[model samples]
Target: MTELVGIVLVSHSPELAAGLRSLLGQIGSAAVPVAVAGGTDDSRIGTSYARIAAAVKDADRGAGVLVLPDLGSSVLTARAVLEDHPREGVVIADAPFVEGAVAAAVTAAAGADLTAVLTAATEARHVSKL
Candidate 1:
């Protein structure tokens, strides 16, 4: 069976991540594995390395994992996790959080490969917001 790429949304607020997940679901890509790594284990308003690492592992199902972080520290945390784990096919997307997640999820749902899914997410950078 072809493995579908997975998405991980990282944010300082659990609400933000959950809301994005809901939005993605409403967009009809619920079958795509989307893991939300938001806030600390204690529910604090910050990124947690452990949480992000766990989410990366959970989201992966062989195809690969694409991580979308909301802010500065969140990106740092995600990079740290990747540096620590160094998993092949896992990537940190340099794009807008919500937009990237949606695009990546939709691409993954269509059974795109890891690089393609990452491209979809990164391409969110080119979205024209007028």
Candidate 2:
């Protein structure tokens, strides 16, 4: 069986990142590798390249990695990590933070490839909330 794509959630708040990971845990996270890169080394609010890069490494299991960053610096920090370590299967998803993460995780758990997982994440932006 092909390895399932991994997910790395990047957020400015450690609690937010962890909480979402917990939520995904109750979802279809059994076969999905999910990691969080939230806050700085000092545990303060903000993003960290080292943390994000490490999470990506931890989540990846020979299939691929999908990075979902929250607002502002989280996005920039994720981009920097991608720049420093340009791996073939590591790609950042340009989608809403919470919705995208949930969608990505669900799709990836279904044994989808990186492209399908990415598409699921990005397409989440269109999910109607009315």
- Which candidate number has the best TM-score? 2
lDDT of 2 at 16: 98
After superposition, candidate 2 runs with Cα above 4 Å error: none
What's the count of clashing pairs in each model shown? 0, 0
Off by over 4 Å in 1: none
For candidate 2, which ten residues in a row score worst on lDDT? 23-32
On residues 1-130, what C-alpha lDDT tens digit does candidate 1 reach at each position? 6778889999999899999999998999988888999998898899999889999999999889999999989999999999988999999999888888888989998999989988998998899889
Per-residue lDDT of candidate 2, residues 10-123 (tens digit) = 999999999999998898576799999999988999998999999999999999999999999999999999998999999999999889988999999888899999999999
**Relative to the true structure, how large is the alpha-carbon lDDT of every model?**
0.91, 0.93
Provide C-alpha RMSD values for all models, in order: 1.0, 0.9
